[model samples]
Target: MRVPHIYQASSIALNTPVSLNDDAAGHIGRVLRMKVGEHVSIFNGEGGEYFSEIIEVTKKSVVVMPLRFDEHNVESELNIHLGQCVSRGDKMDFTIQKSVELGINEITPIFSQRCGVKLSGDRLEKKHQQWQKIAISAAEQSGRNYVPVVHPPVDLKQWLEQHTDEIKLTLHPRAEHSIKTITVPSAGVRFLVGPEGGFTDEEMAQTKQQEFVDIRLGPRVLRTETAALTVLSALQLQFGDLAN
Candidate 1:
């Protein structure tokens, strides 16, 4: 059987006994019902991972000793930073999960004019926490040693104004360029996805002012969630690990 991969927030070193965090402990002891002497892999999102053996298990705790360390890295060579318009319901959650699995390095929740969901104060903080957890979970399941960072929600203007050497891009139905036609992003790529109703004309103009290249996936218009994933896949195939 495959040894389960767990995300432990604390540092891990060889021969050191490390206590799994509450979340991981619960999952291993309760969810998976794993017992002492079982083997598991643990990563701290700092880079690399540890091959560990469960040394103790209790009703509320789980401890492991690091047997070896593997400096495995599955991140894409072409760095990707996604600026995704926050979609309603589980759409945002789904996008966050799949994007991490696809090797995206960072994600920022964007609020556009057409964005229908409204969140602020405590609700916004909680939502951000939830999204970060989803990213971590996705990393664990996808065998990624580094967990992607999910930034707090930001307005369209705030996100657009940030300076980056990364090639900035946004999608449009009538864009003249596709992924294959655009110049390779030497530094990295920072792409934006619109909301359900899509970006307003004013918003598109704002992106243009910021020098974001407009690119289209195909002739047919895609839903916000679909567009984000589709563009990511195309990018990976074009310049990232998928091409290897």
Candidate 2:
């Protein structure tokens, strides 16, 4: 059977006994009901994994002894920074989760004019924390050694102004340019995706002034969440790590 993988924040070394965190302990002991001597893989988001065997399981704690270490470097060659307009409800969460799985390097949630979600003060802070946790968990599940950074939401125009040097491109169904038209830069790509209603003319103009080229996926209209994932998948297949 494939051993279950769990993420731990503690440093791991061979022969060292480590106690699983409460959350992980419950998962192993109650959820999976793993028995003593069963193998489990643990990673700390440090680019390596520890192979361990369960030593003890109690109501409050689960301990394991590390037997070996396996170093894995599966990071993408292309660095993709997604400037995504936050979607409503669980769509945003799903986008963040799938983005990590698809190998996006960084994500910056944006508050565009057309964006439906709104947050302020503590609510904004709470949302950021929740999104960050999602990114971390997704990274763990996807076998990514590096955790993608989730930046706080910024207004679209401000974000464009701040990241002037990034190769910015915004998705627009009516745009003349296609993915094939753009030259793949050796450095990386920073893609902007609009919200449900898409970007306004003013927003599009601002992005254009910031030198962000307008591109289209095809003739059909894609939702805000779908647009980001589609671009990410295409980049990974065409110029990034997926093809490799």
Candidate 3:
């Protein structure tokens, strides 16, 4: 049987007993119904995982004893930072989840002119937390050692000004360049994807002015969510760790 993996925030050491937090405890005790002495893996989003076994289980808590540490990493060689305009409802959640599985190193949720979701104050914080959890779960399932970082949402212009990746591209239907035409960079790549309605002409001009190459996937027009996933998969197949 496949051993389960759980994400924890504390440092893991051999023979050390660690208590699972409320959420993790619930998952192990209630959801998975893991029993004492069962083997499991624990990671802290720090590029390594610990072999552990359940030591204590109760209604309120689950404790595990670490056995050994393993250097675990499934990250892509070509680091991809996705600047995605937040889509509405479950669309945004699905995008964030898949991006983590595809080995994206960083994700910045962008608020474009055409973005449908709007948040402020506590609502923004809640959304950020929710998306971050999705990223963590994705990492665990995909066997990735490190968890992808989901940045707080930012406006499109602000994100463009702050980002400094070696290679940057924005998806546009009428762009002159194709993904095949651009040369791969040595450092990393950042891809900008618009929301459902897509970027306006002015927004496209601004992105181009900031040195983001406009590229098209093909003749067909893809939805915002579709475009991001397609480009990520293509990049992974072409020049990322997925090709290994």
Q: Rate the local accuracy (lDDT) of all candidates.
A: 0.94, 0.89, 0.89
Best by TM-score: 1
User: Where does model 1 exceed 4 Å of error?
Assistant: none
Error in Å for residue 180 of model 3: 1.2
TM-score of each: 0.98, 0.92, 0.97
Residue 171 alpha-carbon offset, candidate 3, angstroms? 0.5
The 10-residue segment with the lowest total lDDT in model 3 = 159-168
Q: Estimate, for each residue in 1-244, the C-alpha lDDT of model 3 and write its tens digit.
A: 8888889987777898999878788988999999998988999887789999999999999999999899876777888899999998899999999988888889999998889999989999999999999998998889988888999999999999974746999998888998988877887888999989888889988998899999999999998888988999989888887667
C-alpha RMSD between model 3 and the true structure = 1.1
TM-score of 1: 0.98
Give the TM-score (vs. native) of candidate 2. 0.92
User: In model 2, which range of ten residues has the least summed lDDT?
Assistant: 161-170
Q: Which has the better TM-score: candidate 1, or candidate 2?
A: 1
Candidate 3 lDDT at 126 equals 97
Model 1, 126-193: lDDT tens per residue?
Answer: 99999999999999999998899999999999999999999999988889988888876578899999
Better of 1 and 3 by lDDT: 1
